[model samples]
Target: MSKYWSEAIQSLTPYVPGEQPKGSNIIKLNTNENPFPPSPMVLEAIHQFDTDRLRLYPDPDASALKLSLAEHFNVKANQVFVGNGSDEVLAHTFMAFFRQPQPLLMPDISYSFYDVYCNLYGIEAKHIPLQDNFCIVLDDYAQANGGIIFANPNAPTGRALTLEKIEALLQRNTETVVVVDEAYVDFGAQTAINLVDKYPNLLVIQTLSKSRSLAGMRVGFAIGSAELIEGLERVKNSFNSYPLDMLAQATAIAAIKDNDYFVETTQQIITMREWTNQQLQSLGFKIIPSKTNFVFASHRYIEAAELMGFLRTNQILVRHFSRPGINNHLRITIGTEAEMQAMIDCLKRHPDIISL
Candidate 1:
């Protein structure tokens, strides 16, 4: 540790993103990215971007993108806040609303980023353990806290909470902020965006990375009451005023407007996810009921790490978290139909994997 670094930086643990292999031929299903390419209209918008606009800073407020998102989500423009990515939006959120006298609460096995954000901001976090089935239990979150946050259709496990349950949490926790990170919501779970107006304390965070096929562009947003959004804006302006560049703004606007393309692509991923789940179950894997674009499963005979290695040897990559409680589980992203078939073929060849 360097002495020159700030005390916060010296003690902070950063979030480790999924591996991005450089090889082109490998089948990548580790990160929850859409297998299909982004819409042609998005590419064309990027191409048609005015080069001269780069000379000037983009709108610090990103008015156009915010307007488009507001219209698309049926919210007021003031209620929407855009940032570099959902991670960034979430970071600003933890710093702004989650720090209070009582500790912030989250599911112990939910997105690892929640812990990272807590560490980064010096926010006290009370981690509520997931239910025996790996589901988030709303009752566990009833304890005193500064704020509550968790991924809907949570990461790794991919199990989703119904909108009714989310509303129940909101109904109970009216004093503190409830942040719903819906990065994978478009794939399966119902969004809490509709409830934002009713609950002034509810904040819903979303990303273009998984559903819009814009992970490369790094655009994310939050929908809440204008007051909640203002808090995030304060943190953002203090950090970086021009988080979205000219091209990113142009590309995101086009991507959000291309409703037909986004719907078709996400539907395809959902279809592939169902197929993958069936195939995994047929291979004797104990599958968690997943609503996200990925499946969390463990085989009866094969261990998670060994199964990962076998998939890697076949040039197919899936995610396996080497941590407490879930060391034997694998989180496999739903790739294209062809990629899933190839993965099944590879699994069939491994005798260690028992087919049910």
Candidate 2:
């Protein structure tokens, strides 16, 4: 460690993102990225952008992008807040709402970034364990907490909570803020955006990266009551006046306007996810019932780490978490039909997998 490093910097166990392979021929499935290209409308928006304005800074507030998002979600302009990515919005959220006297409550096996953020901000966190089947138990969250946040169609596990369960939590736990990270909501999950108007404390965060296929554009937004949005804005402007760039703003607008394409692509993912689940089950892998674009599964006999290594050798990349209780499971992203078949074929040829 460098002597100049501050105590806080030295202590932080930074979040480790999924590996991005250097080769082009690799079937990259570790990160939950959309298999299809972005909408044609989004491409046209980029082509038509006025490049001469590169010298000028983009809209600091991202007003137009916010307007498009508001229209898409049926909310007003002030109710939306845009950022560089959902991760950035999540960072601002931790600073604005999660830092408090009471401990922040979240699932034990959740998006690892939540724990990283809590440690980064010096917030106390209480982890509620998921049920044996890797399902988040909501009743565990009702006791007391400074704040609560979880991914809808949750990451890694890909299990989701319904609107009814979310509202029930809201009805009783009204004292503190509640954040629903809906990064994969478009894939076979209901949104909590409608409940935002009824529950002032609820905030819904979403990204164009998943369904709209704009991960490269780096656009994410939060929908909440005007007051909560204002709070996020205060934190954002204090840290960085402009988080979204000019191109990002334009890309997000076009992606939002093309609702038909978004629907078609997400439906395709949902369909593929179920198909992959069946394929994996046929090979004796116990798969979780996933509503997201990825499926989490563990083989009945083969070790996940060994399988991951074998797949990596075959130029196929899938995510395997070594965390306690889930060390044997692999989180595989749903790719195109051809890519999925290639993966299945590769697995079928595995010597050990073939024996089973």
Candidate 3:
């Protein structure tokens, strides 16, 4: 709160990321990160990267990485845009296509970052509420705005919308850009990348952090028509020419190329998520039908904050938001089998909490 601060900086409320506990004894399921290691190829690529290249700048366009992603997603090289992470890519997106006279349209219960980006860019936003079951109702978006954006398997809820519904929205609204954030699409949801070719107004954003297990490397990308890609490039180059460094470029390329390892790890998480959901349900929790790497559940009698505190005291951490309509729910990331068993054991030890 200093006079030296700019107007935007003074008015901003930045996004709050999940806690990263600093101990080996804690079962960390607060952040929805993959419990498995990144691809072996990614490790080898990092080890082989020449530290001598740090003196020079990385390729501004990230050409090699873009070409590799193009081949993998069946899109042309010109249609791909890479950035530091999906957050940066999304920041560039809000600046590029979403800053319009009409307010941007989004689901009320979608990713919290959408609102943050809107505020940072001075773009007005109109939040469309989700249905009673926490699923997005596409009809609400038919009225319109500057652009539309929502996570596929929506954040904190883990419920996914069908491709038919997404395509239907695109078909009806061809005037403005529609950005589909697919950060967790690899878990069990279908990707909108398949429809990017058919819908010129569609821009699909994805990250290697979740399913590919490269959160530390920080790489994400966007796939859209060449025109939209060029728009993102204009915003990116205007802000920072060299967002992706040499190591990040190499790591992303390797991670995208290893399709077998990616599939194996993603399937393992999905299996674990299902098993965890069943365990929670057996203890009188109402679990949402999740397609992402985490589960959203609410107990029949216990308060979510109390349950969250109880888990944390037992060295297990899950996420709980204080917002209305979902304050009673907990978002638990799917950890390893042993970590999950440990969490269940903690719950069993506190039967009073579950029976409250």
Candidate 4:
């Protein structure tokens, strides 16, 4: 809207992040952040970081973090890339592989930021609609495309495609890059990381935000062929060299190394997600089969926005997207056991909901 803006900026429709309430009283099941704190190892590492290191620039390649991720995922250091967050990693991805003469293909109801990135980069996008059940069918992407990307245990819907399905797509689509955004993969879904060595065109991007409880830290990484990693590095160096700082690198290494804590916390969310689904279904809500740390549900009678308002008034927050096809559904992040019980108990006691 400014006269000084570039043509790309002028035409862009930006992504809107979930609301972060200012108060401490609300049960925040809106943003899909972990209900638990990060691993003790990560916290200890942060506390022990030397302050004097701030005077020196961080490794431009984030070599230490990459090596840690490489070890954790059983990939080589040369095949990994790190960034300030997955959002940045995704932005760099769109710039590097998706901007092409042919349109990039993605699910119509997947991550909203994909659209923003496409607009920002002037990349043509073809939205392949999800089935009536809200699951992606890769066969729909048979048309020619510059590249392909979609979330596994997809956002908002929380439905995941099995690794078998993903590998099937990779087998047929050998000419273009396939990026699987696995931000929520740890909760219950199988990761496509294991298939990377077999499919050189596959790139699996994951973050510490959801399962590792590191949203505050803003770290994300990608695993792929060394050649693909090099392409991302070329694009990253042209944009920002110091994407991950020293403290971020240190803490990320600690988080990745704490395999036991990572497994324990993600299992906790998975257990709570199933319980929440049962609770919602008992209340006459149609719950989608979810593989992530959240559930997507629609009440049989109550409208989504109205239910969101009702929850908000009671000091609870969940996400509701007003877009078509999914406007009736609410995406609720799985909180602690007590938080989930409190939300269900509130609905049980409220006269308006009880009467319905």
On TM-score, the candidate that comes out on top is 2
Runs in model 1 deviating more than 4 A are 354-356
Whole-model alpha-carbon lDDT for candidate 2? 0.92
Estimate the TM-score of every prediction: 0.98, 0.99, 0.98, 0.98
Off by over 4 Å in 2: none
27: Cα error in model 2, Å:
0.3
Candidate 3 structure, TM-score to reference: 0.98
Write the residue-wise lDDT of candidate 4 on 30-137 in tens digits. Answer: 999899998999989988988888999988877778888898889999989899889999999999999889999999999899999999999999999999999999
Writing each residue's lDDT as its tens digit, candidate 3 over 240-304 gives 99999999999999999999999999999999998998889888789999999999999888889
lDDT (tens digit, per residue) of candidate 2 on 120-146: 999999999999998888899987799
Q: Write the per-residue lDDT of candidate 1 for residues 1-356, one digit (tens) a residue.
A: 99899978988888899899998989998998888887888999989988988999899999999999999999999999999999999999999998899999998898998999889888989989998899899988998999999999898899999999999999999999999999999998899999999999999999999899999999999999999999999999999999999988889999999999999999988888888988888888999988888899998878999999999999999999998889899999888899999998899888765433
The collision pairs in model 1 are none
The pairs that clash in candidate 3 are none
Looking at model 3, residue 326 earns an lDDT score of: 97
- Judged by lDDT relative to the true structure, which candidate is superior, 1 or 3? 3
Give lDDT per model, in order: 0.92, 0.92, 0.93, 0.91
After superposing candidate 4 on the true structure, give the runs of residues whose Cα lies further than 4 Å from its correct spot.
350-352
lDDT for predicted candidate 4 compared with the true structure = 0.91
